[model samples]
Target: MNFPLILFILLVITGSIWLLDIIFWKKKREPNENEPWWIEYPKSFFPIILIVFSLRSFVIEPFKIPSGSMIPTLLVGDFILVNKYVYGIRLPVINKKIYDMDKPKRGDVLVFRFPEDSSIDYIKRIVGLPGDVITYHDKQLIINGEVIRMEYEGDYKYIESGLGYIYSDRYSEYLNDESHSIIINQDIRGVQFSNVRQFQFRDNCKYRRTGFTCEVPAGNYFTLGDNRDSSSDSRYWGFVPEENIVGKAFMIWWNFGDLGRIGLSIK
Candidate 1:
């Protein structure tokens, strides 16, 4: 559901009624009697709706991690706060940027609306920027013909609630100056690149048996989940347009399952 759109509608309704009552209906009602239900309710809710709408629309917004695609960095059930204005100021509902700000850097975790289905939101790490060539082979990431530094960490284990434990090799990948951990399961093989859906800029990418190589188009970005082996990301889909960006996820505010995860900074 589009919560922002709903909030915006409520804000408009309440704000209008409150304003109309102040300008025209305030003196029409007797001071002794209760105000009309419509005006009273709207007046009561107008300030609240306006405040919430302003904050969520232009400042920060909260989101929950529903999948383990981010694994060690962001676990399932982690409630995160995304900085909306860090990238740019965009209008709510119809997200159109009206201000310019910093572009996404490599290794930054980003929240974006899925290109194929804008209603669906996805979170992933920025791996490739526009005009860069990204290649993945033998579970290693190569950008612009240079192999990105990857230092083996250790075995990473994930516990599924109903299922048993899953294990993968963990590595700290260095992109630009920032570093983040990623997990790749050798037992889990990737699908043939031919099986991927035809997405925008498909012609720019070349897929093979081992991995794929792509030149990120202008104003677009290539993203991947930290859980490399299990994620269905830009490698399977396509580059995310700048306009699809929601915000940069900064911190984990809550995790019901693991209290220790609360207030952890998201890299």
Candidate 2:
């Protein structure tokens, strides 16, 4: 469902000009009077274009956090802004890179096309870099032969607009050397990690619960979810090709019922 911003802008421009021609310009009523300089123009296209440019280039773009796969960190209905330029500027839609930027780092929240289905966009945290072995066993993340450290922080209250509440474990884990808290539903464990026969880019992945060792393939990355046990990530689907990346998600700009959702970083 991702559309190129260029198409959106073109649509807006065409519609605006055509509408103005019908309402005010057609009759030529004002002529020089116009509707008072600024008022006479659409005045709408500017904001739209700004949003498209910022979202398509140097800043963040809005996205609806879809599934509970990212439960504790992101929730359904949470509309977040993904950092576009952090990983470079690729024109929207076709996703052709015209500008080069930094690559994704560990502990970063990312948005990318599902390796299994490029048409579907999925978000997860980067767990393994190219050539790093990643293993997850007994719910612990093992990367490059080292287990990621996690500290228990009791429980967190789950909040969804109208849904009352539920308590979940609050644990802080360090990845890419960055520390962050995540919520987990213990009742959801016991599911085994499955491996892919072969992936589009990389060939195969090893499976374990204490974590597995996966040398991230060239131009491919290993990703997981902050809500560990819940994500359908590289652990299940396979590695993410560099070309599949949409962008890096950094902020939550707005939430319908709660403005407090704004200004939080994704990691």
Candidate 3:
């Protein structure tokens, strides 16, 4: 629950105590007197906690993948590191950018707060930027009237925790300058309109028997999961707002079940 906020609270508490001891408490105590437990503990922890909080808030942060939504790129047990300052340095807890930096690029894997539920975080690959027209018809991705290149890789299969083995067709999809693997379940025929929710800019999207098309609104992004049919992403919910962005995921630092994944760069 709200790790950043909790860290911030601890930072304030410890920092205040450390400063108070330095300015008032320490000076008032006799030179040879030992410090009280409260002062000693907080003073000792303040520096260490400050270093951790600073690194986590503005440098890089660790996250563990918990779902199959980003299956091919990030597994359920994968522990990834998100670069916090790549898109810009945002304030801790509030998540408001105070400095400007590079904008999010298409094909970049990103972590962001779910629009419908701010408390929850989700990861997906960026497909469309602001002002882009994204269309998904018959499992093909079209952006701005041009079809994105998708080269067939081969058949792919994976085990879902409670569902046993699932199979799909895998392809290397090229978006912008990057190419990443994506899976499509041929069994799922078309976009199910019933699953698309009436989100804020629902009027901008049109659903059909084949699929759907949407013009990405200003300051928002369209994303899709690598595991196409298994994901509940922008197609079913809505675009990710600029403010909801967390950071760009860059590497997999740990994977208990698959040690080979450690130190692998995230595509």
Candidate 1 lDDT over 194-245, as tens digits, reads 5489999899998887888999999999999999876779988999999999
lDDT of 2 by residue, 1-267 (tens): 445656566656756775776787658765555554444344545556656655555566678987767877787778888777778888666677788889888778889988788788899988888878777666777777798899999987765455777567889999767788877767656234443445654445554454455678888888877766556777667788888888888788777867777787777
Query: Would you list the C-alpha lDDT of every candidate in the order shown?
Result: 0.91, 0.73, 0.93
RMSD of each: 1.3, 5.1, 0.9
Ranking by lDDT: 3, 1, 2
Poorest 10 consecutive residues by lDDT, candidate 2: 189-198
User: Candidate 1: which stretches are off by over 4 Å?
Assistant: 190-195
State in Å the error of residue 88, model 1. 0.9
Best by TM-score: 3
TM-score for each candidate, following the candidate numbering: 0.97, 0.76, 0.98
- For candidate 1, the 10 contiguous residues with the lowest summed lDDT are 187-196
Give the top-scoring candidate (lDDT).
3
Off by over 4 Å in 3: none
Candidate 2 versus the native: TM-score? 0.76
**Clashing residue pairs for model 1:** none
When 1 and 2 are scored with lDDT, the better candidate is 1
Clashes of each: 0, 15, 0
lDDT of 2 at 34: 52
lDDT of 2 at 242: 87
